[model samples]
Target: MDIEDTPVLDNHMHLDPIEGQNIDAVEDFESVGGTHLLVLNKPSWHLFDPASDEATFEEVFELTIEAAADASEVLPGRAWPVLGVHPGLISQLVDEGYTAAQARDIMQAGLDVAAEYVADGPALAIKSGRPHYDVSEDVWEASNAVMRHAFDLASEVGCAVQLHTEGSEDLTEITEWAQDEGLPPEQVVKHYSGGRLAGPIKSVIAEKDELEIAAELDEPFLMETDFIDDPDRPGAVLGPKTVPRRVRWMLEEGWEDAVRRAHVETPARVYGIDTEATLGR
Candidate 1:
């Protein structure tokens, strides 16, 4: 079956154009006949780190949010937001030699920035009176307090939390962080699920871990293709093709019911969207 026709909500995508390559060309997402889109935050850490050749985090975040806002406004019911702040941010904290003092500095900087953008920031401007971005300096902490704060923020905002897990290498660490944050497995979604590790080895291990987590949380986990399809964007891992491949894989594996239960049912319930059927009314 063509899974895209079924009206799947792409839990992850980067619609903002940084290099002047307006991802909107793909944002229409013709292949899937996509119902609603969930655009992810720019890869802030990757772009910010001096070690990488990517654009600066400030530039990426600004442009990405602008594009996402525009898309959400134009599309109205079709575009949803899934702001991202992944493990890579922790890595950047470590690389920057984050200490207790640095944590204070970082938090202050974030607060200042949020206040500046409070009018436009998603969470901050929500009617529910919650903050937009989930942030932390705790992952660098030997105790995982920082990560917990981030997850707590996700739960508070009532939006699907997004992340990029390379492979089993950080699986245990992520799980620990999740547990500490009191965010059950079903509440999280892993992006770039395919390109992180070698062969079926990594996928199997990660899937098993995810399954265990989902079972424990009594909720279904979301999987996303975090990367773009454009060949020119060489850094992206999974492109458009991987999306349908995933839906098919889920169906072939007898997880179709789960996808319906988790992706469609649960998301609508938690997010307050009407999912009596798919979004294509």
Candidate 2:
């Protein structure tokens, strides 16, 4: 059997459009044995200026929707959409002289648009989180406020929320915030999560941390490459094929149940997907 036919899901990855890449991003990810992908929609930081106003937010809204659709087009039901304003971009807006109020308004509008897409179709989760340990209190608060908006929208739409935050943060506080927003802890997922932090509702475990995390936690967590879809940074955080490669390693290690949980079962449970139908295993 093809190693990829073993079934694996990449829970966190960026698969947006790029001008210079030679291969199709979706095809590349799938060619490596990826069965399902959760596509995050955000402009590459190095490629575009961060937005600060309503007009800019309108453009961002369209960009996010289009990127999600782009991935879905690649593999039909295989690519799940995760839409939200970039929290780092939120912080950047505030730092670039956009008033806190303006930033909040823009982010709120972006979340509104994202929520609409989720409510409509082809979208499954909301991704809104920022690095918490390295920002000023004011910037932190602004970022947190925007994140609250994301959680609120997730609650309203009944979709999972995928977090992108520092690994060492207090997940307890994050879970509490999710609770306050009326979102169950299980609906809150920490992306790039592992090591030294209490688990959230779910987490997207990095490839290197997979073994350590699988040993430490019993909860069903997802895996990711956090692929930026950048030609200049292929395999930057990790290549698109890393998740499948990790799955192969898991199989070699006799982690059959772990593979099923992270790749098939947990994703279905968290994102409301039909993994059995997708993988036919």
Candidate 3:
């Protein structure tokens, strides 16, 4: 298939209209042949106070939904919201004097609000995971508890989850957590993966080597830039145009089938959206 005919999607990304290059970044992606985005909510600290109540989460989710809506004006129906509590909030909560258990409760409450958004049709998926950095054991356990609650919420909403976590060779434990919660393992995506996960769907970053590794894997996987959309950190994880550019490279290198899976089929399956329709096929 021609590159123009393929639907290139960023499975996980963030857009901030207030402090970041919001819709302008979407235009950049479109200029480079990017077709879709899973616009995610930024962490609480990026938007407002970290230790605020559940109403604060409502505001964050609303901002994400609005961001996605604004992007849709550029990419039409291709941009979607993925809302949730950022796992790093656990550390911030603890530092602010809330106990680990209290932090877990707070995060779960945030997820509860996010789930309502998904169930009500504003968001396509939820974003949740344990802290990517090291922390005390109690905090770690609390983070896991929060993640499990995310899984349950996703199951209830019938949506996928994009996880942000530390690098690991094996993701079997997290996959089992999804299974125990009655959510399919494939619905739990390991965002920013290096393309070496044993279980859970891999949302591999669009670097060349990582994309190559993920292309060789038999299991279905997705691709992303994880673009933070921060002007100061310009292209921190990867640029908005990275996914489509790498997809063109994949096409030139004879990985058309992999491109189809990563850009079209996998996203259609994971997010339960019709990519062909989104691309106006």
Candidate 4:
């Protein structure tokens, strides 16, 4: 059986241009060991502060959903989208003479668009989170407020969330917020988690310590390459092939069950993409 037949699901990846290469990200992923992927558009973490054109937000929204739509032709049920305005973008909007509330409105607009795509089957999750550790406390608060609003929208739309965050200091608070908003903890996914408290589910870097924590988790979680796919930074975090390669070693170490939970079952439950069914499509 092909790796696609084994049904590897990449929980998080960016579909940025691979410099000087004619590459179809969807096909390349499946050619290795990726069957289902949650593709976040390249600028999902940037821009959004044009302060003049509504098309700025529209472009970010369309690019994400359209990528999934385009990928569906190659591997139906395999390309799931994770769309939403990132916290950094909201900060930029605020820096551009917009109040925090106004910034949130822009992000919420993007979420509404993402929710529509999720309803249409191209999007499976919303990606949003607070700022980094170095920003001012006020900026952090503003970012957190925007994130809360995004969570509210995600709850209303009944889609999963992919959070771009540093350490898990606020995991408990975030989880409480999700539950109170009627979004279950299971749907709140924190990206780049390691030494980070597991949030309902999380996508962690594919390092030994990270994988070890995931292997020993009392509950299931996701592992990822967080592959940027930039030519200048080829495999900055890890290459697209890394997840499959690591998983092979994990299996050798008797982590077959954990790997299966992360790669197949959890994704089906969280993202609603049927990995097994995507094969041979």
Question: What C-alpha lDDT do the candidate models reach, one value each?
Answer: 0.44, 0.70, 0.88, 0.68
- Which numbered prediction scores highest in TM-score against the true structure? 3
Q: How many clashing residue pairs are found in candidate 4?
A: 0
34-99: candidate 1 lDDT, tens digit per residue? 444556555454344422222243454465567656655533235554443444444455467775
After superposing candidate 2 on the true structure, give the runs of residues whose Cα lies further than 4 Å from its correct spot: 1-6, 20-23, 44-47, 54-77
Best by lDDT: 3
Off by over 4 Å in 3: none
Worst 10 residues of 2 by lDDT: 15-24
Candidate 4 structure quality by residue, lDDT tens digits, 169-196: 3487887877877888888888888734
Candidate 4 backbone collisions, by pair: none
Candidate 4 — which residues are off by over 4 angstroms? 1-5, 17-27, 44-54, 72-77
Q: Clashes in candidate 1: how many?
A: 1
| TM agreement with the true structure for every prediction | 0.59, 0.87, 0.97, 0.86
Indicate the residue-level lDDT of 175 in model 2: 79
Rank candidates, lDDT, best first: 3, 2, 4, 1
Range of the 10 consecutive residues with the lowest summed lDDT in candidate 3? 272-281
Regions more than 4 Å wrong, model 1: 1-5, 25-28, 45-62, 70-77, 93-139, 155-160, 169-185, 192-219, 228-232, 248-256, 269-278
Backbone N/Cα/C clashes per model = 1, 0, 0, 0
For model 3, name the residue pairs that clash: none
Q: Name the lDDT value of residue 243 in candidate 3.
A: 90
